[model samples]
Target: MKSPGIVIVGAGQSAAVAAHALREHGYRGHIAMLGREWHKPYERPPLSKAVLVAAQEPLLDVLAEEAWARSNIELLNGSDVAALDLAQQEVRLANGQTIEYEKCLVATGGEARTLLCCPPYRRRVHYIRTLDDARRLRAALQRRPQVAILGGGFLGLEIAHAALAVGASVTVLERATSLLDRFLPPEVSAWLQSNLCRAGARVLLGTSVSDAFPVETGRMLLATDAGARLEVDEVVVAIGLSPNDALARNAGLEIGPGGGVLVDANCRTSNEHVFACGDCASQQRPGQSQPTRLESWQNANEQARTAAAAMLGASPPKPPVPWFWTDQGAHNIQMLGLPADDLEYVRRGDPTNAKALWIGHRRLVPIHAVAINAGSELRALRPLFDRDQPVQLQDFHLDTLNLRAWAKQQALADAAVPR
Candidate 1:
């Protein structure tokens, strides 16, 4: 019989990071990772970008074979976990096999939200969620067909950009007034829309596909809510993501408000032996009222470290400010902190040239920031957002102000204060 140690369900970014963190935390025991995917753990960000445009297969593997072998971590790929037997502290697989574990981390992640109006039809419709999904879409895009993206969110814009790069006619349909309206400042959203339009792709705002049907031999017809018809070769859906928490819920783990395994500060689920992280875990942070499932690469990595520490009974690291980024068409937009609608926006540089940083402040306290092709400057600004004290606008009022020096000074000042 194999010795039981830490068993992580779902081999994605969160699972891979948790396994590596365990070894980093000086854990030398039996570690098994079961995943439904055929390939080893890979990153998801490339699925919408490089995977679609490149002819060569992108290196998306998070952990190499040698790393797993060196750590003696058993990876059970293509194994579908049917249920979590909480009573027995075992993971029951679909093939009638059970793996007992001292502790289990559920990082099942999420699935792409599909549209009811445009279901998959003979490969005419595609959704970029898994590796297989990206491969299929990549092959389809190679034909240089007209591509219609269903959403104007990060993924949709990214797919549109990729399609355009491959000589495919692209059109992005968004139901909102602007791209990423809820998250970005109005001016920034406008700039994103303008950039996409300049890249030889059509961006339709306040429009939604009401119906989709086959039009030609290898094409699809999409009807818009605004009474317009668009004939396209492929339809890509990027609406949102739905958490895969059925295993946790069926096993009697308390789920959060928006359909994720409810976890506390330490990423512990309702059952003490089981924990959840990544997109599958919903958490109510220190100041938030409602638990939110953050679907970002940074969140997944940080939460995985936290879950790993908690499993070892070690002190978990403090959560940092929420950050997300997207790359599309000569622009790299990075956002820091949570979204708030009432904050005032102050710009430090010109956004038209794609070198600017916008700070959202409330009562002279920086809450959020958006960096347009200024990632390094954005990193320097983190000290302000991480700090609890209010900052004077004069510190960064000048466009030529050295934010790096300002950040270093603030760090020194913070360290000088007695805890």
Candidate 2:
């Protein structure tokens, strides 16, 4: 006569998408989403880029106010989930209240990792995780603050770009030998570092902070592992993120690499009624060896939609090609899949060329594409990845590649379409 309640935990992008997917699939059951953040769900990408430079429109509303009301999905803000009692189908919140549900989704995403400096200097270190964190960092960058960034990853370089744009002198300390070494190859990392230097920011590789002694006038005398020292007005610690998968672990659910909830291709966890997605969920693709958790806006939305459908007895959507984008300074970096060691990558154009595209190939088969400000063209090549004949470099240079049209012929030639 009535449908059971479906409770979605965490109010981030994935949690919001889960609510929308449940309604889109015609599930008229009771739906509730609880988020720990004080504000309603907002996009986080701009936190490192546009939000730092200027104020913009709100990125809210996975389900707008009226949409939530009309769809009968309860919006519970500031509700921090503490524990889950799977046997009893109840979740205990931080306020000591238990909410009952027939099915639960854990989408509590990750948090920005902080520095391990002196206890008193913790407040001096800034991290950008939420809207409020971004706002605070933006305010601190008002009058050209000398900024010291502690990492050389995408987020760190992004913040460095923003800081440099506002007339701030920036110095980045990266423990690794190259910038974005973990994600990008040496050639790409060199290009990014060159841009950072050209933008009036100093990039220091193989360097780390030993101590941050507070000096007069809100500055810190920083000591480095490489025997260097500098005083900066503000410090940004954008090292990385740690997944928020403790609730799933507490419920005795299987955990994957990097401390994320282990879920299958269908987003089902060890518990039959429990599912997880987004940065908090770790999964292994068919061809991959190690289980990985992707932290991107695309992953958050797509995985949640799939997990919600599976929970509602619907066929899951086809998995995507794992595309992600980053905006740093004035460049738009779009990537399809990550750089793999086994794949031999080829660049369509020279690195000095503005419209260059990098394609990774293994045995002459396309596996990945990395482009700068060439997103539309890069996206068109997705269907042709490892499915068609080896793409010719001359075709890419001459702008004569019609990947979509070529992929259409694949069904006739191979009798199978990639999902």
Q: Which candidate is the best by TM-score?
A: 1
The TM-score of predicted model 1 comes to: 0.95
Pick by lDDT: which candidate is best?
Answer: 1
Cα lDDT tens digits, model 2, 1-419, are 12268988998888887888888889888888889988777778888887888756345456677765666667789999999888988888999988888999999999887666733136556888888888888888886888999989989999999999877889999998888766665567788888889898989999999888788776877899878898888899888899999999999999996689999998999998999999999998745787889999999999999899999889999888888998768888888866677877666655555556777766655667788777776876777653534544435554565645653454235433232
lDDT of 1 by residue, 293-390 (tens): 99999999999999999999999999899899999776898988887878888888887887888888777567889999999888888887777556
What lDDT would each prediction earn against the true structure? Answer: 0.88, 0.81
* Superposed model 1: Cα runs more than 4 Å off: 1-3, 395-397, 410-419
Local lDDT at 77 for model 1:
93
- Candidate 2, backbone clash total: 0
Candidate 2 Cα outliers beyond 4 Å, as residue runs: 1-4, 55-60, 63-69, 118-121, 386-419
TM values, all candidates = 0.95, 0.92
